[model samples]
Target: MSQRKVTMQVIADTVGVSKYVVSKTLNNKLGVSEATRQKILFTAKQLGYSKDGPSEGPSLPLETEIENGYILVVLPNYEYQSISYTYWGAVFQGISLHIQSKKAGMIVITSEMDLSKKVDVPNLIGIITVGTVDEQTLLALSTYNLPIVTLDHEARIIRADSIFMDNLGGIERMTDHLIGLGHKQLLFVGNIHYSQSFYERWIGFRNSLEKADIPLTQGNQKILTIPYDDNMEANLQQHFEELRIHSTDFPTAFVCANDHIARRMIVLLEQNGLACPTDISVTGFDSLEEDKHLSPALTTVQVLKQVMGRRAVDRLVWRAKNRDYPSEKILIVGDITFNESIDAPKKR
Candidate 1:
């Protein structure tokens, strides 16, 4: 007679551990200690254990018997008090929609919302982080060893998948749009070194100019040293200072990294008696509707925050099912929104 199949249960029986622990260890999921995982793996190898499941991937534990299905969602450090109904809010809505469909629970927290605060996460099957997070947070999460996915974050490790907007492509499209409007002497605002996304956007800006045979002068790239890590007012002051420093020789238009910065530049320019698209044209990325300060609508890239969130959740779900696959970096594209913020440069 043929030998009996080597199941996870047989390995568990040999290791004096639960079948669930062996399954978790094999799938690289949570709820298994490192030592136990190693022991189970060693024993399974020794026993020549071959999975009875389909070749596509390992089958998940029966849903009826295992009730532990919870996904932890981490957002960048930002207040959700007023932001709950805006861009981030839409993203959360998308995430919740997916989790609800999957019959799973979720625990949402921000970096600033729970720094050094330990909360109970009993059944964490996966983690999804939105936006760029600090290195400390990334280091802390790397220990979980569970499937993690990110949206709009460029700082992700080997275990995490990143789903973000095509910052470089969107920026290039916006820049070309400005050039089509007959504007030159363009300035790319915001500190490019702050984040990987920003650096890519700056590159797009430079590339667009080169493609159009336009010179990107040294003074055109304004590197504003802002305190974006924590303080808002300080960051605003610094951005204004960088713009003010070149007030005498202001470019015809400015392409900001994001909408928030672009809105602030418009306000500061107006305060100094320069009107947007009249004296200076300004374009931005991530067209959020919550900023009521933008009277003259920003000609920017419209990134679908909710779509990005949904895609990230989908990737996380895929990762949860397939443990052996390499991490993926999916780029979501944005559309250019034509608005009153940019126009042809006025006659000299």
Candidate 2:
């Protein structure tokens, strides 16, 4: 008996791509997108395809372009996350600056591109992802066998180096600050399950309250976990109205998950005939610059977004050189910016 021959057709069929694509990809030429090229390469390797002959067995990409010194950066397709967004933009700027200093190339792409299209590039050293990427996308990336470092993301199913802010500690400090300012009746805003970071922030807030023996009543937890959508502002306003209608002991401060939600909370409080700080104080995380222009600057935690990007690049380079090392999670500590948004609870 003899073993079957492994050809481009076999790889193409296995990968569900056309033979032309397989040929272009195997030859390391243009005409195929990064995703398609990766798929074809993985399939060829799995099927034991050899360019020389069957006797030589499987042969993978030459990888000679590793000397090209290029790094691939992947971003999720969410509208709220991009290179231009305040937080993400700062992180990308850091990645860009560090890559330039190291004299390396960076290629950025979103997860929602047409996988069959053309995207020419040299063989990459590794991948660094920003924001929360879907598990399926991460699994697809793993096929390339390149080291991956994720910034502000943690995947349960895939093993990769991850870097994010000290979400838990940041929120805990903020909550302590509000409590010190004499705020007892407190509410936490933002969807707790929106992301791992958000959930950690909620936990930190709760931890501080528990230490002080501040009972978490049903009303305090009512609007904390509502998911954001097109009508988030309206929905938040409605919740506020309901709180006023039912209870005279309304919350005196709101610990928001992020700066955006904190700003929104301030506005909603004003519309509900409550003055921020004077009537109720609000605190937030991610001390974004856009919030500085607000009447009372948001009291929030300052996340090192750009520093997180630079650290992620450092981790990816380290992983590329030390492939066998265990994956590590790097946490960057954030500082609290004491601003005017928080004040002592008004006398009843």
Candidate 3:
């Protein structure tokens, strides 16, 4: 059958208004009078005109079905070394499972790419962000007016919900454990970022030192502000060497920023003829499985990765459903898993 010829201009001419006004009124948009809206819609339907097809008129509701929309998942850096796949894997798995259960679609994007030039998709419901988000990216997300849920790092631009591991409490507990083992000279190795996790961990380390009456002088702490590049290891080694030289007393125990750094530091120490726990005790955060196989078995804090993942999905879903819900900041506490790497300080 030949298709019926129905155009928006024909409808506008019949309604005695411009095409723009007819388009707005037919779309049920604001700024048009109630009488005008009714008149435009009635005339368009009577003329067998439709936005989708003649058989399907523009009378379709503006509301989208929950299963029809897409959720954008933005990862800050696409580089392999910058992100922990294991952690992000669990988070994406949780989000994917929830999206599948709701019969929704997912669009994964990375901040490394220029997304502003890309075309925007309709029915974009919300965003699940993993890793750090800069101010520029946050601004882009805000323009969408969609709910946002961040994991790992919290951004100031987005007031949406955030879920992260309790870095302060976990580090404090780890420090206390070392103190209980009779370690007097303790050292904290950390990056010089002001990220929420980094700042919290630094605060926890300082608090633990103060509570134990241990002096937190410049000599005992090392802040390595090494840029993330191929020379990261060399830069860290230089800092390690400086700490070994300048400090009057070698720290009997060292609390490292994370498991990966701790493992590298352990290797560096051994190369310098220092045995872990025997000569110097070591501890790390994020109890990764690879650390377990280390000669001495690294002592570290076990972040509840799976639980954090599940909680993030729950919060996003809840916020998407209830717009009136208040923004939430959730910190999931982790456990201190003791291992052979940590022991009483060796007598000088």
Candidate 4:
């Protein structure tokens, strides 16, 4: 007895279906019921049909052509908010441009997805991440063994390439600018997360205050760890009132984490019958979109967001092509944009 050769028609006949149905089922295409699809697949396998063959399995190439390479871009947040859009837009543009120049493509992903669930995507040559990732997530990315480049967040200590803005320098510049305007009692407002950027900014704020011989007293500093959302206005207002009550004297200035916070603080101050630059001067980091349009244009440190984007892509691609490349920390400096929000401290 000789073994009968197995074919789609044979499988269809065995499963009591048309050859077209078996073909569609094997190709994993639409139109086949789940039960029918499973029956067709099981029968074909039992009959000694090679499931790994091109006709039976997925048709993706074993290795994507080098000329048509693809990379993955990851962002920290799911939605566009704050200055994230600006940074994301510039970084994505840089990655897309670079990929297009090399006749390749990029697939952008957000870390907002629950990592416990599985994701389906092609093998990526490299990754460009925009924010700090937790250790578990970092381990998962390391499992891929692909070169990653981070922007705005520190990537040096981790097993990845990085391009970050000189956040400490920017904060220092902003604080110094306030000091120059005769702001002795300055308040630094920001979250105290260990993420590199935030940590650096906090360090800069402390160092600037210490250099000026100003004590880091509770009355002169506040750290808000709460989420900025619908109730943010109320929360901030309450926090501000508490600060005012505690302080022996009102701080002459406030250095905020970013422009959004500064804007909110301004509004809250006005509501409480306090005015900026007259009652207290204010400065912000990450020159945001609405900064210039505010009643008093914000004085802020403009991070080289677009430049950071381009550098991140260039470095990631370079590392992807050559694995032995030494990782580097590229820090772009930001400049202060002076505006009406800052002025000499008011007379006591």
lDDT of 1 at 164: 75
Best by TM-score: 2
Q: Candidate 1, residue 281: CA error in Å?
A: 1.0
Q: TM-score of predicted model 1?
A: 0.71
Give the least accurate 10-residue stretch of model 1, judged by summed lDDT: 57-66
Error of 2 at 321 (Å): 1.6
Alpha carbon deviation, residue 14, candidate 3 (Å) = 57
- Tens digit of per-residue lDDT, candidate 2, span 1-348: 787888898888888988988998988898799978877876676667888645345443332333448888887754424556998888888887888777788888887764344345656788888888888788877766788998888866777999989998998888888888888888888887788899889889899998888987764462456666667788787777766723557888889999988888888788777888888898988888777887898889999888988898788877776664457888899989988888998887
Question: Residues 230-273, candidate 1, lDDT per residue (tens digit)?
Answer: 46445665655655634555578889888877888788778767
TM-score each candidate.
Answer: 0.71, 0.76, 0.74, 0.72
Best lDDT among the predictions, by candidate number: 2
All candidates in order of lDDT, best leading: 2, 3, 1, 4
Name the candidate, 2 or 4, with the larger lDDT value. 2
Local accuracy by lDDT, each model: 0.75, 0.80, 0.76, 0.72
In model 3, where is the ten-residue run with the lowest total lDDT?
Answer: 56-65
Q: Number of clashing residue pairs in every model?
A: 0, 0, 0, 0
Residue pairs in steric clash, candidate 3? none
